[model samples]
Target chain A: MKKLIAVLTVLLIASALVFAGGNGESSGSGKKVVKIGVYEPASGDNGAGGKQETLGIQYANAITPTVTINGTEYEVQLVIVDNESSNDKAVTAASELVSKGVSLVLGSYGSGVSIAAADTFASAEVPAIGVTCTNPQVTLGNDWYYRICFLDPFQGTVLANYAKDTFGAKKAYALAKLGDDYSVGLCNYFIKAFEALGGQVIYETFPEGTSDFAAYVTNAKNGGCDVFYSPVSIEAAALIIEQANTQGLPMPILAGDTWDSNVVLAAAKGTNVSISVTTFFVEGSTDKQITDFVDGFKGYLASNATALTNNGGNDEIAAVTAMGFDAYYVALEALKKAGSTKGADIQKILPGVTYKGVSGDIAFDKNGDAVRNVAYVKKVDNATGKWQFVSVQSVK
Target chain B: MGFLQTNLPYLLAGISTGGQYALIAIGYTMVYGILRLINFAHGDVFMCAALMVIYSASYMPLYISLPLAIVATGVLGFAIERVAYKPLRTAPRMSAMISAIGMSYLIQNLALYVTGGLTKYYPPVPFISDSIEIFGAMTKRVTIITPFVTLVLIVVLVNIIKYTKIGIAMRAVSRDFETAQLMGVKINSVISATFVIGSLLAAIGSTLFFSNYTGVTPTVGGMPGLKAFVAAVFGGIGSIPGAVIGAFIIGICENIIKGLGWTTFSDAFTFVLLIVVLMFMPTGLFGEKATDKV
Candidate 1:
């Protein structure tokens, strides 16, 4: 009986090995495998945002399955890892991607994590294409890190200008989350630009892990500010929206790219406040290319309900997802232009490569940042229970 | 008058938040008193209660779900004590403490796994979350009710400890474990009762807490747990009244500091206050001086 049991165990182990081997060979039997690594936060503070970004990349991969390189077809496989939305975990996640031998990488929705993982990618010589991490330091001195979206400075200024032009605001309240690199950075830029536009600004901050915003909203109301600008994460934004509405602090609420979330939209439904944000993409564009992409993406989401949950349980397309979609196509274009799937080869070909992506016409400037001027302004139409496209503002 | 007008809202917020801290802190104190072991899992029990509401509120009606979730949380606390703490009772005190910590990690990671590290939206209870204007400060109804609820629970709990048979058994077990066993006290049942009461309070606390926040995350219990634990320590670790007072003091101080525009220093100020209290009083405001016989 013991011998028979041992024989069965051996047979099971051998079959498992055979199945694993069979799975590996079927993907690249006659084609070269080109890997694009996704380092995202599947858990942690920024997990929701990171999951949405991953969905966009996965959708793009589904649409464009293969890229031809040097008269040979290469299967594009995505190697994904969860960074847990932490700086320390980002280093480990980035190193894991490096070990996977991915030709290029697209990732990281949060700026702090992206900046944390930048050195790993730079040292490994693997060019990383950032989707929606808007902190300026991400691409400032790092040659290997390229972003497909505008930086916080531009986004902050656009928001400040929009407040001035649309609302005719003379006073603004700048609220941020303390110790957050993205919130503090964007808040400072907004203050500077608002002050430059001759608007009085009162700056305030709340500590991390704070679930309360009543005091801050009350402070803003009593301070006599016409506009409330809080560039915070989505979870915090949800609470702020609810409180601000209940408090009846009737001011135009403005934010940077992080506010472009369906979670925030869902929270803002039935609220009295007008929520607007400057972001990388808007779905209801008249541009045919964008319209086609949005339609196809909706169809993709229609079949995949789980994907919709990852995008905050709504059908609305997020700006970060659109940016993720564009970042994937951009990496593919660079890979095909290089005609070789080496890090250095793709990095060389990436400088001049441009693709009119689903989000926008993506072209890199001298600093490996997207040289785009237009920012989409979207507002939550509480009446319609949807995020409505307002207008596009250009940084002149 | 200007100062009073400006600071009234902050004071109310502090009181509401303080009540939450006290509710959670009482759990820490009571369990510590009975077990002579710092039950680190108490905070995670609070987190589980909040998550239970978020999940159950989706399918069940609010009225049924609220009571059902609280009872489930109480049962979870009871089970945790039985499985994790009860086995380590005969072993060294350190073993039970470590088990408590282990149970904490287990619950947190399980929450993380089940929720997929996503923040689940707390289904808004109609009247509990509605905002009402008081003294020109607009705040939720939960904020006003938290302190009164906490006070009523404390009075009822204190009376039980002073009078009831199970409560008297609990006191005896906390006073002397071996002697209580010799005197025919059901030591195991007493410990389980302690957990049940602690878990009930935590469930109630979590309902009020999540009502204000309106969103639940896996690590939601972590900060509040740490703060409540700090309140427990500051109030003299095993004393109930001390824990409640310590929580209120910390809550008020942090909010006032934040309202003063030093938002960055508010959290730091909490630790600083803890350190100062430790240095000065040593045993806390209402803590009894214990004499150890070697």
Candidate 2:
């Protein structure tokens, strides 16, 4: 009986490991395959955003399945790894991509994981194009990491300017998640820009795994702030929106790129609370490129139930997804520019590679950051459950 | 009035969450009373109840789905004991505890696999999820209803343990596991009954808890589980009333701290209370003094 139990335990563990190994095999196709590693969190706080970001890359891959390098056509296969939206897991995820022998990498919607995996990519000489990781630290001092989205400082200032100029706010309440690189970094920049505008800013941070935002929302309400800003994960954002709406919070809520998601819209839909965010792309754009991508992406999502659910059960295009699509094309551009599958060659050629993505014109500056200044501010249309483009703003 | 207006929201939130924690804590306290082992998986059971509702509600009516999920959770709790803890009943106490910890991880990982690590939005239960005002402060109707729900459940649970034949058998078994078995108390059934009742309360707790919090993740149970465990220990691990009171105190204090702008230390405060309680009163507030029969 004891031996039987031991065997069962061993079998359970063995089966678990096998299940965890998860679809790492490459295709046995006739064409030459060039692997592009997708290191993003498919689970955890940033899972919703990361999954949508990944969907964009997947959609882009489906649309452009092959890329030519040195006049030879190679099948573009994505090697996706879930960093679990944790800094600790990022190293392993990055190494898994590195070990997979990917030519170039795209992704990591959260800046914390992107920054965490920066050293791993740098050490492996792998060039990573960040999809929507907006923290400046993601690319600062890390030559191997490149991001398509604008930095937190730029996003933060744009939001601050919008809050002051639009809301005519004197005092603002800012809440961020403790120890979250993206939330804290963006909150700090927002505070700096808000205070610089001669506006009083009250900043507070809640610990991770905090389900209750009642106290924090009450703090914002009682503090007599004119505008409330919390640049947090989608999971936390939903809870906050619920709490804010419940409390009849008087002020409009402002956030950075993270809040520009279907999750936020769903939470704030048919609610009295006001929410606005600065992001890369707005869905319902008349721009030919964006319109084409949106139509194609929605159709792609509709065909797959899993992808549609991962996109928060709708085809509403998130800005991160748009950036993810752009990031994929940017990586392909790098591979084409280098004309080689070598990581070192891709890294060297990445600084010069440019592409006119659906999001915007993506060109890498000397610091390997996107040379862009303008961001589109979007407000949640509560009645419609869609994002309404307010205006395009830039830092002077 | 001004002070009440400022602090009432935090106090109300604390009480609501405390009641939720109380529901979970009773499970810990009761299992510890009978088995003398910490049912670490109790929190995951609470989480599973929420997940069950989320998944079931997609296909079935809310009323049917809620009851079905609660019943399923109770069954899960019963099966957990039969599979994980029952076999190790004769083994060393530490072995059952290790199994409990293993079971906790198993449930969390299984949940992770099923949800694919996505944060599932808890479908709002009507009426209870409705936003309402209390003394110029706003919160869910569930918040006001939770403490009463927790109290009523505890009263019913206390009476079952005090009066029913199975309750007498349960008390006998908790008082002396081997002796109760020798006295034909049907120790196994008592243990199973304890798990079912504990799990039912946890299910109800998850309902109220998720209505306020709403975002249900795979590992969401870990914090509340640990907090509920602390509440059990703080109140006297074997005493249900003690656990409930301890949960409320921790809940209120934690929220008050957050209201004071010390959000980082809210989680830290629960552990600090545990250590302080352990240092001064080892057996907890209502725990009977340990006596050796030499």
Candidate 3:
């Protein structure tokens, strides 16, 4: 009886191994499915970001040409991999995508993951187009890298302009999560810009994970700043804003696109002071292109068997849909111009192709950054749970 | 000095965080002192309590949510001891320890898979986010609530172990399970009760932790769990008071490092303290010597 059980166990183990091996090799040389890899946190704190980026790709593929990369035609496919919101996972995902023979990859909102996968993409000779993942090092140190978004310096200057001219705030306090590259980068950039604009950053602080904010809020109250800035997660932002409201602290809080979430609105609502955020798209806007993208994204989601529309995700989907549409069509237009799927061929032709995208007309600079549209700031209406357009400014 | 004064609230916040770690550490110390097998899965017990708090808060009022979560955690601790533990009571100590580690991984992964590893934000309470000022220092309502609640819990736990009948039984079991069983003190029941008390404390810790942290993730308990374990060893693995002291020390030390502008060193600071303590005192600050029936 024991021998029989051992045999069964071995067989089961063998079968499991076989199934795992098969799953990895299932994509045959069939229809020219161009497996584009995605590098984003499919789980953890930034899970929403992964879905947002991928969902954008989905809508772009739906509306754009059948296939185009460097002026050549080929069916497009995206092999989604979850970075689990860790840099280690990003490296693993990049390697896996390379092995799967993907020529292009999209991803990685934070600088850490982009850096992690830099060598992998470079070694594989595949291009990585970063979406809103801005830090100077993301594209500067690597050859096979590009980004559709502006860097921290640009974002910082835009925000500083709003603080100085828009809000008329001359003094501010900055609280940054020193542990993260994104937070530190954004904080430094904002301080430089704000200080240059003659606004004093009176006080600055950093704390570990979602701890009580009363002390910090009180400190901000003490510093007597007209504005308080924390480039933090939506979860952290909500708690801090809620506590700030509770303390009757009257400083206006300013932050990056990280503040663009329904939960932030939910937390800030009914509080004495309204929280404002900067980001790419505002959901409740009546702009023709903005509404068109939202409607198209919802339509695409409704048709796709696996598309999702929950957890304040439609807004996220709308943002990505715009980005993805730009990426896909740009690649297709490039492919038609190149008349080949070869990396070398397409790389040469990419500098010449131009297409007016959902965000703006896409044109790559010599350094490989898309010099497209500007980023806008939005305010959350606590009662309506919608984004109200506040202002638009260029990162440059 | 200006930076320190400006960031003093972060340090104070760290102290309150240390207080929560103390509560979780006590549970680890109490369990380890008697069993000599690390309750590796203690953090999951803490996570379960937080889950219970969120789930129960939906059905019951917010006031009742904490107690309900504590009770649920205690019940889970008892169940874990009864099912996964009791069968290995006669097994080798290493086997039990391995089982404990395996159970920890199982619980954490299960939570990760089920919760999709996302950070779940807690719905704000009516008056919980309010802040109070002391000596010109700002204290959040939850911080004030947490420290006082933790102190009260420590007192009650101390009283329960010092004067109660179950306390005597637990002590007897810790000394020698065989001897205690021979003396007609139900070994399983006493151990079960000990786990229950430890879990209840962990539950309270979790509730307080989530109240301040505002969100719970699969890996949220990882740092706290490992830190609480280090606290247990620092205080004396089997010593309850030792664990609490160890936790507070680790917490305070981490904050001091963070306050010093070496924020990247925050994760490593506590472990460095542990290594220093172990180098000087191997038995842990309060760990006892127990005989093994070889």
Candidate 4:
């Protein structure tokens, strides 16, 4: 009799736990709900950047809670999932959003995770809008993935030119993390561009989970290189920055879009290291739309402690957050244009949808990539821990 | 002179990293000496110490928080053994080992939940974090401080084992668990002491290690923990000095390999060394030769 009771109690608790995970299909307020899946890394190499991106979406959702499609007011609900900044986890996270039956998805701070989940979204017929994923392969052949950020090829060339022209650097040392698609891909593009500019380039790849970058920095310094470039994730970037400062690296450091983060700023602050990165948007822009975003996003971040911590313990706005804010509005525009909440319907109209975002005017080309040409180059001011605008770079 | 100038930084980093590994290896070696079970959770315990310092330092001053964190980690280690291992004392040895692995994951997952998977930055220590010049090569002062700290701690630990009553009880218990128990050696207290000492060393190691690296994630301890385990095996699991020497060699070699631009092979080299050592010296450099019982 005791054994029977024990088994019955166990089953009851298990069933209760299962039921606790409520379905998103039903709304208690008697309103039609349109779910937008948020696929971002909340915990991994890209977790810091991912949270800031998600913050933009959350802020956008808070301000515009509903979208009027055709004559009905449909409530917009966000389904957020952490991709954990890994390829295998990205597929699982993508499938989870698909299973949640999201009408459209906005996501993914890192290009590697975005590319990893491309096929999943393609098969599910769900359209995903990339926020800050800069790798070109993210939307190359996958009709389902649409990105708002500029591709790596442009960003890489811009940084390489900045190195050669601004710093007068002739020899460049480029380092990347092995197996990380974003760093390796961006590093390759930078190398190609640097070499094309009649500069000598030496490159090396560090394995993942590498906390010790002393040797790599020493190699760069000892190699008699004029400039150092390592377009890596925010995590590795911080460690490398510290090592660079410790080693008293004489040459300036260069990186791609991933370095345009407050995490990078915080790490490079108060250090003697010089860091420059090309990114989508810079904070404190003179444009009215960007100013509004900077003000409102700062207010939103200040209101929530968790959001502030996720923003690297400050109210400083990151470029990815602005892109995230823009990605959310773009999803809404696609929904409004399509006039339907089905994944297939959104996919059909995404390529035709264009919205003026805080970053810039967003319009997709035939490859489902944003038709962006110019990138903002910014340098970290080590003294004040602020970003100083360097120049607006564009490739002819 | 040119070769030395170019490779000096790598050698320094290796020695510093080796010192940190030695501190963690001692924890593995000491626990293995008594329990004969690999406390896989030792690495997690080290991570917990770092998290504790990072979180506590936010509220209290470093002087108070640092020691408080180390003491709290020791308590956590004591609690883990009592909860996970003590209940299964009479069970098969494999069960205890499995429990250790489970405890490791449990602590890591708990840390992940608390930090929300964000990499928490380790607050910089004043003197140790300052940059210093060693033979014209620039590096953190912790590189110079780590070797001395590790040696001092080892000397104190060795002296305690050589002189103290509790230390003698621990040795007897490790040598013969049943005989020591029959002789009223108070087996549980000795076991608890072993855990406390090991955890305290791991805590200290975490301080020196993270002072240089400066980033503390939930899974940060996994690699160092694995490397330290290999160090223990290479030096003979139950030998303390052997583990220290093994850790230094591995640390230096790994960094020198990175200097050679073989960064990809550095981690793989540690395992290759382990396999070679096992094949040639199964008993390890300082390990006692085992005799079969009739």
Candidate 5:
């Protein structure tokens, strides 16, 4: 038995040496590889949204496999790490990316986790371009963090305006998830905009893991609000929609980009409440770039059922996916302009880097936030339970 | 009338949530009663039941799927006992408990691997999930039926424990494990039977609980499980009726606090109740004082 165990250990060590040699020989054969890290939650509360965002990055990588820097072609390798949608885990995942020596980082669907890892990225001198994390604090103090999506203040204002202008709502009720930075920040901005528009704002919050919304819906109904806005996680949104429908609430439901999920859409199906949200990208656009991208994305989904499953098992192009795709391209553009894979070089050229992505024109402000003002307003048709493009609103 | 109208829905919601907790707490109380060990894996067993329903319900209808899931969960509970606990039965009690905690982690990680840590939507049952109005308060039919079903099951369980030979053997074992073994009672079968009953209740509780929540994540059972364990401790660790009452009080008070806009303190309040109960009455409301043989 001892001899057999010794023989097995020898075999394992021999195979390990052979594999290491093979890896070295393969890497030495060709082009230089630059790693672009993807730090997203593949598990935990934000897992669903994180997976969708990764889908976009994966698609973008497939389309543009390599980037040219100083007339030398370098293969772009994506180093994906699951943050587990937790603040503590985000720090570790961010460090892992830094240790991988990535040129640029893209990711993190939730704002709270992004802000948690902001310090790690900064300390490591790694620039991370957020995909859909909308909280202002994610990029406010963290010079290493940049986003390709609009901040909560802009999206919140657009939502408030849509509620006032489209529905002519006077009284608005805002519901937010407690302790969630994205929900709380967006809800606060929405309240400010609604109050500035001379509309009465009623706000309520539910703690994390709250499964029931019956009482909250009843309160909203009793308050006689014209519009109800809840920028919460998809799980909470589903409960809210179902309870609101059961209670026979008449008011229209409004939310931020996070509400633009197939899960939310499936929940709101056959409900009395007409749901609308301000998102980054609206599918079926006439723009050649967007149309081509959508077509290509559909083809990718057809060939890859696993990606389709990650995207809620359909071809519906989620807004976060489009943002993720844009963030990857923008990172590539920054890398190209900087002519170096060093983190500081990418950060130096990231502000001036502009790319007309599939979503929209991507550019950043001094605060390292996306400078775009346009938000695509999509409404779920109560009859068909499908999303329909209403109009694009620009926030000042 | 107006005050009652505003508060009636919250009260009903509390009762339903309480019923779910009571069902799960019964499992905790029963296992603690028999083994004098806190079965930390009880919550993970509840989680496994829900996951079983999620994967099974896709291929089969609830009527067929529900029973199969319950039996499978029961078998899993039995298997866990045979593998993790039965070996350490003669060892120190602390060893069995540590094993239970380790088993909980193993089960949760196993579930995470199987589901890939994705939250799957719980398929809504037709008749049970339908909403009905009660005194101007609109709630699901499951809410009204939960407490009734829990009470009926409690009565049936009590009868089983009091009347049947297996039940008498169980009582004897809980009273004195060595004495019961010396009296020619089969210790292994009775312990297996205890796990079977506890697991069955957990399976039923998972069905009712997830039906309301409508989404099953990997850690879905953690909070409910902790709260249920607290409920068991709050009532009296070995007492069934005590667990049920403690669960209702916790559920109602927490919901009322949430309604009053104190959401953060609502969960914190359960632990506060437990601490107060421990300080004032260390053995719990229905716990019998045990004197160790020095």
Candidate 6:
């Protein structure tokens, strides 16, 4: 029971934060304390993402104890709101963060979640940078919204191009989540790009979350497509991959950024499992910024260590934390260049400013997308238990 | 022939799932027949059984996990009866119903909290899943074993309920709890035993289900439990045999619909079938009225 409880504790820290979300009277904290809110799924479905985001925020705050804004140093205090990794909850967290009068908000770690929070940020005019949530809808409509990761269109193209150029895949099968707009959207984009690149998708099937995917895996295996592309929800991605491997189907399993998680990789590890994901950042890069993040995060956890015995040597590539470091870095850079901590001043220059961050050089386009097109394609190293970024595929 | 043979294994696998649904439904039917209340929390109990199975089985073979889960669930059922239902014996019907609903939510979310909401993989018994040809169809060993096991369990369960002393007490309680108590039968033990038996069957059913699916989720019991409740009601709720029949019909129909590529409406088909049966036979397929001898 305790082993189960320990695993659950690691997962449910955010849902506990969610209790904090609904209960606390709006502190209406003044701008003196640099409050940044994170909305992540803490308990259900996407709890891992939510928990990882907390780590990111804590690490970033440790490295930069106080954010210098317009020459005044404001100590960072992150107020987290658990979105339960749900779309509706993400919106609620965003509105709650605004109501609390935080200068900035970070998180809600998937594309669907970002879309849910988009309208609230648009109305409030707050700057946010998501970690691994790569949907285009997050940054497109809101002037105040931006992400540290690349968008779906580019990611879909990356997969499409990889299938074409690398595998020489003339025919592929698309297995996606039926009711999920995120899976369907990415699958559609990938199919469109693949066909345009002189490839063919012979068949496509949509499965519900409860649908046992073994049957569908068999169908794709029998379909004899050069590849099987399942743009799945983060929640269901690992299960689908596991079943695929168990069925002994040999098709290369390619998926979206939702595949970025330690549990997903660990489950997929050492099974000769090959999955391609366009991620925000890949580990093992010799970049100084990457090294600093690795060292700084390890230090933060070591200084606050309690449960080293629990993780069984699980490395920290938790999305929310890495994205948090980048988000704080982005915000800090904006403040440095603006020479003022005023929200209005920082918001104005955010679109054009460029800074080298953990993922890569960060430059927001007019639509608030990163101006650069660097997408890290990584496969899990079953031996090393680390994600090694293969060729850095640039789509621009 | 290749297409038929290729798909036969999957189709047979579907039957394995159907078998568990039927077993769990027997409990629902037996409970429903004696007590008109549908135990919504039965699914949550199944979810609880799954957590126990995962934890207890990690240190031993899965063959050991099945009995451990069943016994644990039975104990849980006894506890549930004492804590959640016994006090509400004289409460309003609405109150009991509300309590059951609340219990269902509590158990499920607690599981979501306890299990970290991640799916746990339980691989099959080694070398047990090799396929064999039958009627020009290739099927896994599980597909061959599940139906026979389900039938044997059903027979054994039915025989005990019909012939045993406790079975007589259960039958007497179902007819009239006060009268049975007047007859010096221990009413509390009978009710607790009934619930214990029901939970035990569900644990067994869900274990078979996980064997085929290779995992159990917090929500795994939700749909299966609902269908079992429906099965119980369909088979003349209180009648143990009726629930088994109801289970088969629902299980076979669901798989056939999925097999036909009309999965979008598979759930609708079961509900429609249940509705049609309830409209004409409100008392269910095998229900009998209790006649008073004054």
Q: Supply the TM-score of chain A against the true chain A for every candidate structure.
A: 0.91, 0.94, 0.84, 0.95, 0.91, 0.84
Between prediction 3 and prediction 4, the one with superior lDDT is: 4
Model 6, residue A34: distance off in Å is 1.5
| Candidate 4 residue spans exceeding 4 A from truth | A1-26, B290-294
User: What lDDT score belongs to each candidate, Candidate 1 first?
Assistant: 0.87, 0.91, 0.72, 0.90, 0.86, 0.70
Evaluate residue A370 in candidate 5 and report its C-alpha lDDT on the 0 to 100 scale: 88
How does residue B82 of candidate 2 score in lDDT? 98
Total clashes, candidate 5? 0
Task: Indicate the residue-level lDDT of A87 in model 6.
Answer: 68
Candidate 1 CAPRI assessment class: medium
Instruction: Give the alpha carbon lDDT tens digit for every residue of A1-396 in model 3.
Output: 999999999999988854552323123655455666777775765665555666677677666626744444456766677777676677877777777666577777566678788888887777777776777778876656777766777877788887887679988877776556777888899999999888898544554443445556766676668888887765567668766765667767888866666557656766566677667654555778767877878776666545653334333343444565566666666667767655556667666767776666677777667675567887767577666778787644
Which scores better on TM-score, 5 or 6? Answer: 5
How many residue pairs clash in model 4? 0
Order of all candidates by lDDT, from best down to worst? 2, 4, 1, 5, 3, 6
Give lDDT tens digits, candidate 2, residues B101-217.
Answer: 999999999999999998888998999999988778888999999999999988998999889999999899989888999998888899999999899999999999999999999
Cα RMSDs, all models: 3.9, 3.0, 4.5, 2.2, 3.4, 6.5
What's the distance in Å from true for residue A200, model 6?
3.2
Regions of model 6 farther than 4 Å from truth: A1-32, A202-211, A270-273, A298-313, A316-321, A335-346, A381-388, B57-66, B120-144, B214-217, B233-236, B266-269, B272-294
As for TM-score, the candidate ahead, 1 or 4, is 4
The sequence of per-residue lDDT tens digits that candidate 2 reaches over residues A1-396 is: 999999999999988865653443335676888999999999999998999999999999999999999999989999899999999989999988887778888989899999999998999898899888999999999899988888999989998999899999999999999899999999999999989999999899988788989999999988999999999999999999999988899999999888988999999999998999999987776998988998898899889998999999888899999899999999988989899988899999898999999988999899999999999999999999999999999886
Q: What lDDT tens digits, residue by residue, belong to model 5 across residues A295-337?
A: 9999999999899888888888889988888888888899999
Candidate 4 lDDT tens digits, B1-294? 777778899999999999999999999998888888899999999999999999999999999999999999999989999999999889988999999999999999999999999888888988999999877899999998999999999999999998999989988988999999999999999999999999999999999989889888888889899899889889988999999999999899999998887877888999898999899987677876766352
TM-score of chain B of 6: 0.90
Model 6: per-residue lDDT, tens digit, B189-228? 8878888988898887766666556555677678788877
Q: What ranking of all candidate models by TM-score puts the best one first?
A: 4, 2, 1, 5, 6, 3
